[model samples]
Every structure is written in C-alpha cells, then in structure tokens.
Target chain A: MAELLVYLAATLVGVAFLLALYRFFKGPSSADRVVAFDVLTIVSVTAIALVALAEGRGIYLDVALIYALLSFLGVIVVARYLERGL
Target chain B: MDIVGGLLLVGGAAFLLFGGLGLVRMPDVFNRIQAGTKATTLGTLLGLAGIACLQPDWALKLFLIGLFILFTNPISSQVLARAAHRSGARKSALTAVDRLEEDHGA
Candidate 1:
C-alpha cells in the first residue's frame, strides 16, 4: 500500500514538473519564468520525500533539506537581479 | 495507518498538480505566484505529513522540513512579487486594486 502510494504521488508530481517546465520555457517575462522555476523546485523537494519513503531510506531526507535551501537562495538571487540590485 | 498515509500522499499530489496548472493558466505573474505558492505549500506539508505517518521514527525530521517549507514559501513568493512589480511587470487588466501603487508609487 505504501509503495503504491509513493508511486502514485511521484507520477503526479512528474506531471506537475512537466507543466512547470512548460511555463518556465514559454513564460513571456523573466518573473514568470522565475516563478515557474520556484514551483519546479518545490515539486522536486516533494518528489525527493516520496522517493525516500518508497525506497525506505533516511538519507534522502537530508538531500531534500539541502535542495530546499539552495532553491530558496537561487530564487532570492534571481529576484534581486530582477530588481536590478545586489 | 498505511491507508491513511496513502490517502494523504494522493491528495497532496493532486494539490501539487493543480498548482502547476495554475502556473500555466493564470493571466499574470502575481496571480501565478498566488496560485503556485499557496497550493504548493499546502501540498508539500501534506506530503511531508504522509511521510511522517509512514515512517514514525523520522517524524521529527519530517516535521522540521514541513516547518521550513511553511516559513519559506510565502517569503520567497512575496519577494518575487515585489521584485516583479519593481521590474515593471504589469498586473492583469482585470485587477481591482492599485493601492500598492498609490502608496509606494511602484
């Protein structure tokens, strides 16, 4: 049951990732692409969590944590650049 | 317990999918950020909760992850919106308010 759930969630998130990728590429403005990128990272973190459960591994949770932090930093830096400031 | 966890996982994934749909469909950057941040944050919390349920021993760490998400999602979205506005991304024509503009001349 748990495995089935993990698979289902991962599949759904994969679909979400595709949609986000489309927006990232098709967005009219830089901000639009940045927002799409942010959504993609969030979806990836969720994916990591689901995969960790499916594989019965604890180490992947740490990966999720680090990924989340780095994504936050990336978004902030891009936003700052968009604002034409440091 | 497993069944409950599975349900949470499915529901969270559904929310996540909706967020992505909103990102594609929303008319403007602000609306897109609104949809993306709210839906994804809730979805992520639910997904983390489901994992906690499935792995009782990892509950504390999962909780911390969820907490981090809750705090950061809104902050990032807010900063993005502010930067978008500062960079002159126009709002949708249908938008009702310009208070932020009137107040700060943004």
Candidate 2:
C-alpha cells in the first residue's frame, strides 16, 4: 500500500511540475515567472522526499535539504535584483 | 503505520497539485505569489512529515528540512511580492485596491 501511494504521490508531483512549467513559459511578467519557478522548486523538493521514501535511503533527504536552501537563496537574490535592492 | 504514512503523502501531493493549479490560474503576480507560497509551504511540510513517519530514523533530518522551509518560504515570497510591486509589475484590472502603492508611495 505504501509503495502504491509512493507512485501516486510521484504522479501528482509530476503533474504539479508540468503546471508550474506552463506558468513559467506563459507568465506575462518576470514576477509571474519567478513565482512559477518558486513553486517548481518546492514541488521538486517534495519529489525528492518521495524518491527517498521509495528507495528507503536517508541520504536523499540531505539532498532535499540542500536543494531547498539553495532554491530559497536563489529566489531571494532574484527578487532583490528585481527591486534594485541587491 | 504504512497506511497512515501513505495517506499523508497523498494529501501533501494533492496540496502541491493545487498550488501549481493556482500558479497557472491566478490572474496576477501577487495572487500567484500568494498561491504559490502558502500552498507549497504546507505541502512541503506535510510531505516531509509523511517521509519522517515512513522512515523513523530519518525523522530528525526531515524535521530540520520542514523547519527550514517554514522559515524561508514566507520570507522569500514577501521579498518577491515587494519586488514585484516596486518593479511595477502590472496588477490585475479587477484589483480593488492599491494599499502597497499608497503606503510605499510608489
């Protein structure tokens, strides 16, 4: 049952990634694209967690942690640049 | 335990799906930011919790990740919203107010 749910969760996350990608491509402005990018990174983190669960490995969790940190920093830097605050 | 963990995983993924939907469907930058930030934050946290439940030994690391996301997601979103406003990202035509503009004098 847990294995089945892992697959289901992966499918959902994949759909979420595609939706975010559409927004990234079609967004009317830079801010909208940034928002889409932010969502994409978050979804990816969830995907990584799901992968770790499926693989039954603790190491993948470290990758999720680092990815989340870097993504947050990247978004912040881009936002600051947009506002000319950087 | 497996059933409970699976349910949480599915629930979290569903929230993420909604967040993505909101990102695409929202009419303007601020609305998209609102949807993307709040929903993803919750979804990521819940998904991490589900993982922790599924793998007991990894619980500490998962909790750390969740805590980090909870702290960073809102801060990043707030910065993005302020930047969008300052950079003159167009607001939706149906937007009823301009509180940020009034307050920031931008």
Candidate 3:
C-alpha cells in the first residue's frame, strides 16, 4: 500500500515538474522564471523525501535539507542581482 | 498508519500540481510567486510529514527538513517579489496600488 502511494506521489510530482519547466522556459520575465525554478526545487526536495521513504534511508533527508538551503541561496542571490543590490 | 501517510503524500502532490499551474497561469510575477510559494511550502511540508510517518526512526531529521523549508520558503519568495518590483517587472492590469513606489517616492 505504501509503495503504491509512493508511485502515485511520484507521478504527481513528475507532472508538476513538467508544468514548472514550461514556465521556466517560457515565462516573459526573469522573475517569473526564477519563481518557476523555485517551485521546481521545492518539488525536487519533495521527491527526494519520497525517495528516502521508499528506500528506507535517512541520508536522503540530509540531501533534501542541503538542497533546500542551496536553492534558497540561489534564489536570494539572483533576486539581489535583479534589484542591483548584490 | 500507512493509509494516513499515503493520503498526506497524495495531498501534497496535488497541492504541488496546483502551485505549478498557478505559476504558469498567474497574470503577473508577484501573483505567480505568491501562489507558488504558499502552495509549494505546504505541499513540501506535507510530503515531509508523510515521510516521517513512514519511517518513525527518521522523524527527527524529517522534522528538521520541514522546519528549514518553512522558514526559508517565504523569505526567498519575499526577496523575489521585492526584486521583481524594483527591477520593473510588469504588473497585472488588475493591480490596485503601488505601495513600494509610493514609499520610494516619499
């Protein structure tokens, strides 16, 4: 049952990734792309967590945390540059 | 327990899908960020919680991951919105006011 749930969640997140990719490439403004990228990273972290659950591993949780931190930094840096504040 | 965890996982994924939809369909950068941030934050948290339920021993790390996400997601979105506004990203026609502009002028 849990395995089935994992597969379902994976499918949903995969669809979300595709939609986010479209926005990332097609957004009119750089900010829109950045927002799409941010959504993508969040979805990725969720995927990583799901993987951890399915594999019964704890290290992947650490990977998710690091990914979250890195993405946050990336967005902040890009945002600062956009505002000419960096 | 498995059933509840599964429900949470599915619900999170659904929210994530809506967030992506909002990103693609929202009228302006700010609206897109708002929708994406709120929905994805909740979705990621739900996913993490579900993972915690599936693995009782790893709950502490999962909790920390969720906490970090909850704290950072809004801050990043706020930065993005501020940057977009300052960089002159176009606003939707339906936008009512420009508080930032007024503040800058004052």
The RMSD of every model to the true structure, in order and in angstroms, is 1.2, 1.1, 1.5
- Per-candidate clashes, comma-separated: 0, 0, 0
Q: Give DockQ per model, in order.
A: 0.83, 0.89, 0.87
- Candidate 2 global TM-score: 0.96
Q: What is the DockQ score, from 0 to 1, of model 1?
A: 0.83
Better of 2 and 3 by DockQ: 2
Q: What TM-score does model 1 achieve against the real structure?
A: 0.96
Alpha carbon lDDT at B68, candidate 3: 93
For candidate 3, the chain B TM-score comes to: 0.95
lDDT of 3 by residue, B1-106 (tens): 8878887888899899999989888999999999899999999989878777777788888889899999999999999998999889999999999888888841
lDDT of 2 by residue, B43-99 (tens): 888888787778889889999999999999999999999999999999889999998
Ranking by TM-score: 2, 1, 3
Please state the CAPRI-style docking class of candidate 1: high
Candidate 1 Cα RMSD (Å): 1.2
TM for candidate 3 is 0.95
- Model 1 C-alpha lDDT per residue in residues A1-86, reported as the tens digit of each score: 77787789888989999999999999899999999999999999989988888788989999999999999989999999999977
lDDT of 2 at B106: 67
Worst 10 residues of 3 chain B by lDDT: B97-106
On lDDT, the stronger of 1 and 2 is 1
For residues B1-106, write the lDDT of model 1, one tens digit per residue.
9878877888899899999999999999999999999999999999888888888888898888899989999999999999999898979999998888898888
